[model samples]
Target: MEQPFRVCIFCIRTFIHRVLEPPDDVKKLFQDYSQNGTMSMDGLLKFLSKVQGQNNAKEDDAEVIFNSLKHLNIFPRKGLNLEAFYRYLLGDLNTPLSPRVHQDMTAPLAHYFMYTGHNSYLTGNQFSSKSSVRPIKKALQNGVRVIELDLWPARNIKSVVLHGGNNDVEVRHGGTLTTSVKLLKCLRAIKEFAFQVSEYPVVITFEDHLTADLQEKVAKMVTKTFGGMLYRPEIDGLEKLSPESLKKKILISTKPPREYLETQNSNSPHKSEKTSEEQGG
Candidate 1:
């Protein structure tokens, strides 16, 4: 119930009105705090401070929360009841994710257990899945900070995602009969939705099977699509790069040519290692 006071020029009077709504166990708690079958601002303030851990909670803060959850048509008009409390707490207002970035973003990317999505482009089973941007968008929207894409040459066309013409490289699972999603299109989707939910860095790990030329083309496409949002490590080791320093940045990772060649040579019968330019000299 609310005791709203009113004074009309010379006349003065007061009126009382009511009403409210949370869950069963929570409902018991709410009932415990309420008075005279109505939840007033004081009860809510107590709940916020003690139960919800808003230790420094003030009446104003409680008012804000109550106003948001309180039923407009309820008797008190500005009061929260059992149902209102239950519904708001169970709704999006009570999302598990923190409203703002609270963790130590200054730590190295390795220090964080990022929400990673393996083969994020596939909509179904890996062997016979359709490659599309829907999954990519959903992942980004749901706060998947790391995405994996396997890049290969496009079927029948070198390129298709970029604006100029065909995207020479496409994304799919390697050595499997799976559909492909254009690299540029994927990049575009990443660019568009990467930070929609959180202002954190997104790492894209590539299972690259493209040749040197196609790799160059992909690099261009990525640069064009992401523009300034792409993280180009100005320094050497990624160990020094912190997540705080890479906010809103897109970091792409793939095996280097030297590493790829070394692995291939290790599997060969002759195992003849080619000399690098520096060693050749």
Candidate 2:
């Protein structure tokens, strides 16, 4: 049931009592919860009041907010949403209008990837088929939620798992037309191989060279062959896709500059960007 005027009045009275005389333990609990990203607006208000009363000497509200946020697991990992918090602190709550409480900062776990033509591990030794599965296995073992793959398919018929050109195969096979191999074998190999290492679901992200049906086919294959491990669809021009499409299990493999992200958050209707092969597949 909706809260009526009497309910609002009761809530207002409760809030007044809370602000005027909050308990000592409330501050500690508020600090704990705020650090964990579990703090509510009521908790924050109580905590701020406690801090103000304790210090009679004024403190920077920004510092207090940052200290509270430092407790979250995402802090020092992903960039902080400072602007939204700043607005909240400065905005007039009793005015005709107010900004949102806090812009959503929740994000899925992500892993960085860089593709190489040759299967050389970071140790500079050629990877055996046994060793070839090591990097992927490690990612799975560490509970990596996403795996980015780079592709350069001339025709959408075969999705080549490559970020850039492969000259090693050409040199070995000795022909101009004999370019990189285009087959599902490598992708299938990762799936079959990772299953041996971990049971947790893995989301495979693909970066293709602007093909039409390739994304659809890959999406089908991901659902059919790999138990829906695909995390991205139509790797290029993600800004063009509708909002609903962007919100599914799929994510566009684009990491724009911090400035771009801030600008988009402030002005643009879209949040994703056009990814370069340099950022990872």
Candidate 3:
């Protein structure tokens, strides 16, 4: 018999009961935490803090419990202490503010984590309009804090979710083709889907791959659709452009390296333009 799927409410975690077993220690800790009604949230935090500092438990085991508690709202929502707790749990010391093993007790984790839906999907044509919606909805349903979409310019330079294209049977046409959805349609669909899921503060990030003209149009469309809800990451070439310009236009991926882009003079005419200019001169 096949196992049933179960979705956990607290952390928006999900699993197939048949295929996976819960970690015994983690299960015991959670059961104990729930049974200890007298234990305050602060006490729980302190316990985890101490456990994290001791470095006795394997890092992987500790992280599973920490994330589980996070979904259960057992930890502080935000603060310096929570930040340190996250760093300790992740075993990350890349930042300058790494928690001190002995003296530091504060550092609060950020309240949210962002993820994309298509990560685990095995479908080759996963970028299509229909195929993409399932993961997007799943992410929203599972409390994915933020979502990123790769937008490519299609016919008429219209933006749509997908980076590149080829032939495939699962797609609308028999074989692989280009994206058929428009930027506006995608935005509206996302807004409606997110609203239905009751996931507020949806962060929609756009990874734009388009020409200058198309970028401007896509940016305007997003701004009109979501107002300030849309997010565009800082690209390398864009630093020279004013913030206002960026806000008004869709941001492309990190621009070509400054050295390469600068070396090619914009004033040089194209073959056609050069021929015309030379003939006129």
Candidate 4:
């Protein structure tokens, strides 16, 4: 038998108290550097260096450290606010405590850990399961930033989302299957629950296998459902957008046009080579 993991409420409460109400020495240190409720960058560097036991720290070393802190949004352009400085020292400055900082947005896209959900519309196993919009609602409420939508064309209906298999396009686990959920219902649920948890953007990864007419319907549904919240390169232009810029927006990640894919392949260094052996020759 397996034992369930449990959280220690007493430990959590004690930690929260320590964070919310810092020790006297920590408060005294903040007071020492604070001037008119703010501390200059130079003063902050001096304090940090001293705390790290780097006595008589060089100017270059201090500047490097300051740059890193600025990246974390710990220091403002001129100085640091008293409360913000305290939060930084206590290490509760990002996300659940506050909005993501500029540094968090400006980092390379590959660096961030995207909270993702696979087959988001399924309530149970894929083989035999009931499809429902509730899973999307719950996942978004829990701060999932990326969701997968598998689209297929239906006979009587337009388009629906489900895990594909030898069986019909319905929600199912290994062998068990459930009724299919409409694509529109899932989209509406996504729109409703997206910003409830976090102001961050939501990405929908579409696995589309639909007829041309059904594909058009899917496009129309997305436009109608998301409206102004949709991220369109035509409207915003083809510039590198940061996470901060995309807050409260819904972005769709799907297969690119054939021409676009061809262009990308043409640009590859080994485009003409058939294989590693050909390239070497």
Name the candidate that leads on lDDT: 1
lDDT of 4 by residue, 146-252 (tens): 99887764433323225332122322222234556777778889999999978878999887665555567678778998999998876645355767778899999
Q: What is the C-alpha lDDT of each candidate?
A: 0.78, 0.39, 0.43, 0.69
Off by over 4 Å in 2: 1-145, 154-183, 228-281
2 versus 3: better lDDT goes to? 3
Query: What is the per-residue lDDT of model 1 for residues 1-281, given as tens digits with 9 covering 90 to 100?
Result: 44656587777576756333233688788788887566778888888778877688898876766666544444365467666666556766567665667667887778878899999999999898899999999999999999998888777442344443645578888768888878878988999999999888999998887778888888888888899999887766688788888889999998855546877778876544444444677
lDDT of 3 by residue, 1-281 (tens): 13334465444434433323345664454445433333334434545555434344354544554555454322544322332343333444323453333432122112223344432211236434243355555666675535555455454322223432211111121124424334455465565555444323454555444556655666566677766545455474433444223322222223433333544555455755887889999
The reply for model 3, stretches above 4 Å from the true place, is: 1-112, 119-135, 156-179, 195-200, 228-281
Which runs of model 4 end up more than 4 angstroms from their true locations?
A: 1-103, 108-111, 155-176, 235-239, 256-281
lDDT of candidate 3 vs native? Answer: 0.43
User: Whole-model lDDT for model 2 versus the true structure?
Assistant: 0.39
Let me know the TM-score candidate 2 reaches against the reference structure.
0.27
lDDT of 4 at 228: 98
lDDT of 2 by residue, 1-281 (tens): 12224455346322221113334564445445365434544444554566434223234543455465565433343323333233334434223442222323232232223222232111123321222334544554554535555444343223334543221111111112223333244355456644443333344554443234544555455455554444444565434443223332433342333444566576644323333333566
TM-score of each prediction: 0.68, 0.27, 0.34, 0.50
